[model samples]
Target: MKYRNLGGTGLIVSEIAFGTIPILSGDVPVLPDYYSPNEETAIAIMEHAFKLGCNLYDTAIVPEYGDAEIKLGRFAAHIGREKIIISDKSRYFIGDEMYDAVNRSCKNLDTYANIYFVHQVDENNEDITFGRYGAIDALNELKAEGKIKFTGVASHYYDVLLRGAKDKRVDILQGSGNILERGMLERIESEPLFKEKGFILNKSYAAGILPHFFRIETLLSGVLSYPISSVLVGMGTNEQVDQAMMMKTENYSRPSFSQVMSVLEKSFVPIPCDRCQRCRCKYGTEIHIIFRQYNYYFLGKDYWALRKLDLSINESAAQCKKCTDMSCMKKCPHEINIPETVQMIQRLVEIHIRKSLI
Candidate 1:
């Protein structure tokens, strides 16, 4: 496995870190069965990955809750913890809740994490993350107490990551970057803060859409071409572990920017709204969020993605009916019929809600 320095943490990590979310089932409300492997298979895949030189393991609170950490801890004990790097994440927990979550994570993992992350902090909720008794404070306290060696922020938003990097408290920054999602790659290349901090790129398969080898190769090549520390892959099977190992040792040519763009365009699923933000609602409706949620739902076909959309709809859908002026449709760059799309999404949400009730 190719190794690289993890930002300024003085720790060396494999370029392809093993992400463990796909390995276990959980009680997380959305898509509980999605990507879950049996315990035996999960353990075997992880062990095989370790033997193949994948030294970094990342797990988050969602999807598997603490199950992934417990399994990882058992594996760590068997293989010797010192031989691997453990990365854990806590999502939206703050103050005492954050402390309790970390404590539980450590206990479940059976060792202090080498890197602990404030998972999924975004620009919209920056205050909740950086405010009093927020995730940052909790992470800082954990670091000071020596429970975790380093603190990092995992965000889908570049602006939030930039803020975290500038805070100087964060030792690592994790973001989603793939051929389909190249915004983070561009930000990392151009932004000094991203260069200065440890950057771990995840969602390389665009949340499991690009499962075919050819698509994976194109996406991996595009991401590997960037100057980042590590690219995380969710390997649920032995074949995937082997493929990751092979990719590291193989001399595959990286795809050009234009080629990557071509692939993305060819593979792209059409989402009518372009998120111009020029579309104004008299009732202050967030139409862009609806479009984004629908995009995720359409691409993933997973209930978790839909659940998020459901929540967004619950919050914003009411306002759409109140808008007298159909100004959003006029403002759309693609001139998409906004009202028709919103109604379609509303019907889908209603169907999902009815099914869940049944």
Candidate 2:
């Protein structure tokens, strides 16, 4: 496995960091699938990944990742804690909550995390996470206390990540990208501010859905082409570890975003939105994230995606219909028909909800 500098951290990390989500045995309703390996089996899988040159092991606190952190702690002890880099995270955004969360994470891992992130940050809580005595402040405090070596902000939206890039407190950024949802990654690559911090990308397979539509190598190579420090792949079985670790990251020609969309088009009518987060609704709706759920619904996350859509589609679609403003379309580089697409998404949700009742 090749290595890259975890930007400005001076720490070398494997191109493929081991994602600990799938190894946890739990009924995590959010995920469409999980491996549910026993504790011994989970540790073995992580250790195998380590032997394959994967030094970065990423996990979250209990209940979020369902005991994976504890298992990773055991694996770290088995392998000697000094040999690997541990990345831990929690969803807390308040200063006190974040402070306590990091301390809990350190105890769960039996060692301080090399980097800790405020996971799943979004526009709703971005201000709280970055504000005075917020999560970032807590992480900074933790860093000074030697509880964690670095601070990070993990979000799916580009605007939030850009704020993180601009903030001197943020040492690393985590986000999702894949061959299909490469829009945000494309925008990130062009922005110079991001180069100052390290980027670790997850959902390279779009939460394990894209692999059914595209080759794993295709998905891996597409995101690997970016300047990201590491691309995380969720591994459960040892075979999966081999499949991901053995691929040659360099010298592989990656398909363009259009080419990836074309392949996906053969399966279903893909929403043309790249999730760039540029199209803002005068109403508080997150347009790019709605588009992402629409695409994910067609990509095999029907239940989870539709559930997310149910939260705002009705209201957003109503607002789209009532509004006369066309600025969202004007801002879109792709020139996507935002109003029409949102209405179509509402229809999809209605149709799916009706079908499920039958």
TM-scores for all candidates: the values are: 0.77, 0.96
Write model 1 residue lDDT over 7-37, tens digit each, in one string: 7889999888998876767665432224567
Q: Count the backbone clashes (under 3 Å) in each candidate.
A: 1, 0
lDDT per residue as tens, model 2, 1-358: 9898998998999999999998987768886467889988998999899999999989899879998899999999999988999999999999999999999988888889999999999878989999998999999999999999999999988889999999999999999988777788988999999998999999898888888898788888788888899999999899999989988656645697688789889878988887777777778877888988888888888878877898999999999998998678887877889989999999988876537735
Q: Would you list the C-alpha lDDT of every candidate in the order shown? A: 0.73, 0.89
RMSD each, Å: 4.8, 1.4
Runs off by more than 4 Å, candidate 2 = none
Task: Name model 1 segments beyond 4 Å from true.
Answer: 29-40, 61-66, 212-214, 248-358
